[model samples]
Target: MSAGWIYNFPFEININLKAIDDAVRAFSVKYEAFFKVITKSLGGLVNSINFVLNKIPWFVLILLVFIVIWRTSNKISKGIIFSSLLFLVGVAGLWNLMNETLSIIIASVVISLLFGFPIGILISTSNRLNKAVRPILDTMQTMPVFVYLIPALLFFGLGKPPAVIATTIYAIVPIIRLTNHGIRQINAEVVEASLAFGSTKLQSLIKVQIPQALPTIMTGVNQTLMMAMAMVVTTSMIGATGLGMEVLIGVNRIEIGRGLVSGSAVVIMAVILDRATQGLVQRSEVKTDGQ
Candidate 1:
C-alpha cells in the first residue's frame, strides 16, 4: 500500500543491451576488410565532391544558385536574396567550410535517395513488405541521431566517411516514408486504368505511378535534405570538417563570436536549401495538379 510499491513495478526484468553491442562490434571486426572497402569508397566520394565544390569560381557558384532558385520559384528577387545570403558566408570567410559541409550533405542525400527510393517503391508494391518495413522505418526515425554515429565510427573510424554514413542513416527515413505514402495514396482507378490499357506492372509503375507520386516524393527529398543538414553539427563530433567543425572548435575554445558566425552560416545554408527545394516541390505540385 506504500506509494513507492504502488507506483513502481515489482519485477526486476533486465535486458542485456551490452550483449547486442558486443555482438555488433564482433561482427564489424569479423568483416573488417569489407568495412574498410566501404570506408575507402565513401572517403573518395566525399573528397571528390569537396574538390568539385571548391574548384568552382565563387561568382559562378553564386550564379548557379541564382539560376536554380530563379528557375524553380520563377522569382528573380527571391533568387537574388538567397544568392546574397550565400555570398555573405563567403564575406564572413566561411566559403570553404560551407563547401565542405555541402559536400557531406550532397553525398548523404544522394546515397539516401539511391537506396531509400527503390526500397520505398518495392515496399509500396507489397502489403507484407510494407508492414515489415514500417516498423523499421519508424525505429530508424525515432532512434537517437547520435546512435548512428557509433556504428558508423566502428565501421569507418573517425572521418568524413563515417560522417556521411551516419548522416545518411539519420536522414533516409523521410524519403522512404514519403515515397511509400506517395505511391500508396495514388488513386486506385489510375493504376487500374493503366493495367486495363494493356500496361505491364513495370510500365504502369514507371509511367503512371511514379509521375503521380513525384510531388510527394519531392517533399520527401526536401525533408531528407533538411535532415542531412541537421546532422552537420552532430557529424562534426566524429572529425568531419566543415562549418560544423568550425562551430565545434568555437564551442571548445568558448569563442562565442566564432560559434555564432558558423552557426549563422549553417542557418543561412539551411534556409537556402529549404526554400530552393520547396520551390521545386511547389512547381511539381502545380504540374501534377494541372495534369
Candidate 2:
C-alpha cells in the first residue's frame, strides 16, 4: 500500500478512469451546440472588451474612470485616489496586460450576477432548492481552483472562453449564497405585514425584500468581483492573457522582480475595486438603517 498500511487484503480498488472519460466525451459531443453558443457569447464579450481597452489611450481611459468615480463618489479625493491607482497600473509598463485582466474579471462578474441573482432569488423562495443548492455551492467554494480548470478545459477547450467560464463558476458562489442569505434574513414580520397590506407577492419582493437585501447582495457582488479577478489571473495557465501571464512567466523563469511587480499590480487593482464597492455597501446600509 502507498500508505504502508497492514490492510492489504481489502481487494484492489480499481476505479475505471476510462469510463468517466468516455462518459464525459459522449456528453460533450451531445452538447456541442450548446457549448458553441456559450463560447460565442463569452468570446464576443472578451473581444469587445479587448478592442475597447486597446483602442482607448491610457490617459483618456484613466481620465474617464476618474470622472465617473468622482461623480459617483461626490468627492474629488476619492476620484484622485482611484486615478492614482490607475496611474500605477499604467506605470508598471503593463497597461495592456492589466486591461486584459480587468476585462476578464468584468466579464466573469457580469455573467455571475446575471445567473447568480435569479438563482439566488429562486433559492430564497424555495426551501427545497435552498437545501439542494447549498451543498453544491459549498463544494464549488471548497474545491481547489485548479480543479475547475480541468472541466473548464474539457468544455470550452482553452483560451479566454474556458477562463471566463471557470472564473464565473468559481466566483459566482458568494453572490448566490449571500443574496440568498440577505433575502432570507429579512424580518418575517415585515414580509407578513407587507402581505397583509394587500401587496402582491411580486410587489412585496420588488419593493421590500429586494430593497432590504440590496446591501447584503452588494457585499456578495464585491466578493464575487474579487474572486473573479483572482481566478482570471490564475487562469492564464490555460492560455489566458494578462497580468497572470506575467506572473506565470516570472514563475517559470524564476524572475523575482517580474513576479513581484505583476503580483503587486494585481493587489493594487483589488484594493481599488474593493474600496469602490465598499462605498456602495456603506451607502446601502445607511439607507436601510435610516428607514
Candidate 3:
C-alpha cells in the first residue's frame, strides 16, 4: 500500500482503538461494582415494600388509590378512574401482573425523585454546570431505549435491577430539565425582593423560588412517571416480568390474542398513570396561581 493512503494509518488507529477499549474496560469494572452495591441496598428496600403491598388485598389497594386521587383531584374523576382501572384489571385477567408493574413503577419513580431532585437543584444553582449537563441530558433523552438495555444488561445482567436502571435513565431527563428551567425562569424581581428581605440563598430557594416553581417541577415529574412506565414495559425483553413479558412472548410466538391482551394492559396502565399525574400537575398549577 502507498504510504500516503488512508489504510497506511492502521498502526496509529490500532493504538488509539486499543487505548479506548482499555478505558472502557476499566470503566465497566468500576461501574459494575458501583451498580451492585447500590442495587443490593435498594433491592432490599423494594422487596420490603413489595412484601407489605402483597399482604394487602387488591381491593384495598384499589380503594387506597381511589382515596388518594379523590383527595388530590376530586371525587367524580376518582370514581371514574377507579372503575376504569378495575375493569381493565378484570378484563386483562392480570391483576397480579398489574400490581407487579405498579410496584416497579413506584420504585423507579421514588429512586428517580430521590436522586433527580437534588441533582436538579444543584444544576439550577450553577449555570456552568447546567450548560455542561444539558448536552448529556439531550443524549440520554434521544438515545434509543433499546441501546440502554445493552449496557444495563452488561452491568446488572437482566433482571429487575437492570430494568430499574434502564427505566431510571429513560425517565429522569424531564425532571432535571424542568427543574432547571423552572428555577431559571423565576422572576428576577421576586429573587431580589427575597434578598431585600434578608433571605439567605437557601431560604429564597426553598420558600420563594421552589413554591413558585412547583407547578413546572410537578409537570416534569408527571412526564417522568409516564416515561418510566413506558420504559419498564420495554424492559420486559430482558427478563423483567410484567405486562411487557406477555407482549414479548406474544410477539415471539405469534400469539395474536396474547399480544392484544398484554398491549391493552400496557395502554390501560399508561392512561391511568398519565391522567393521575397530569391531574396532580394541574392541581399544583391552580394552587400556585391561586396563591
**All models, RMSD in angstroms:** 1.6, 2.8, 3.8
Better of 2 and 3 by TM-score: 2
What alpha-carbon RMSD in Å does predicted model 2 have with respect to the real structure?
2.8
lDDT of 3 by residue, 1-291 (tens): 466667565554335867765776677787877878876865666566666767888777667667666766677686567656766675668877776676777788888888888789899989899999999999999999998887677767766777888888988888888887888898999989998999999999999988888888998899889889888568897777878888889999999999888788888778777767878888888988885
CA lDDT of every candidate: 0.94, 0.88, 0.80
Look at candidate 1 and give me any clashing residue pairs: none
TM-score of 2: 0.91
What shift in Å separates residue 252 of candidate 2 from its native position after superposition? 0.8
Segments in model 2 whose C-alpha atoms lie over 4 Å from true places: 1-9, 64-79
Candidate 2, residues 1-291: lDDT per residue as tens digits?
A: 285456556467899999998898888889999998998899899889888889998999778768867765789998898888889888889899988888888889999999999899999999999999999999988899898887778878888889999899899999999999999999999889999999999999999999999899989999999888778567999988899998999999999999999988888888778877877887898788975
Over 4 Å off in model 3, which ranges?
A: 1-33, 70-78
Best by lDDT: 1
TM-score on alpha carbons, each prediction: 0.95, 0.91, 0.86
Q: Candidate 2: lDDT of 34?
A: 93
For model 1, give the RMSD to the true fold. 1.6
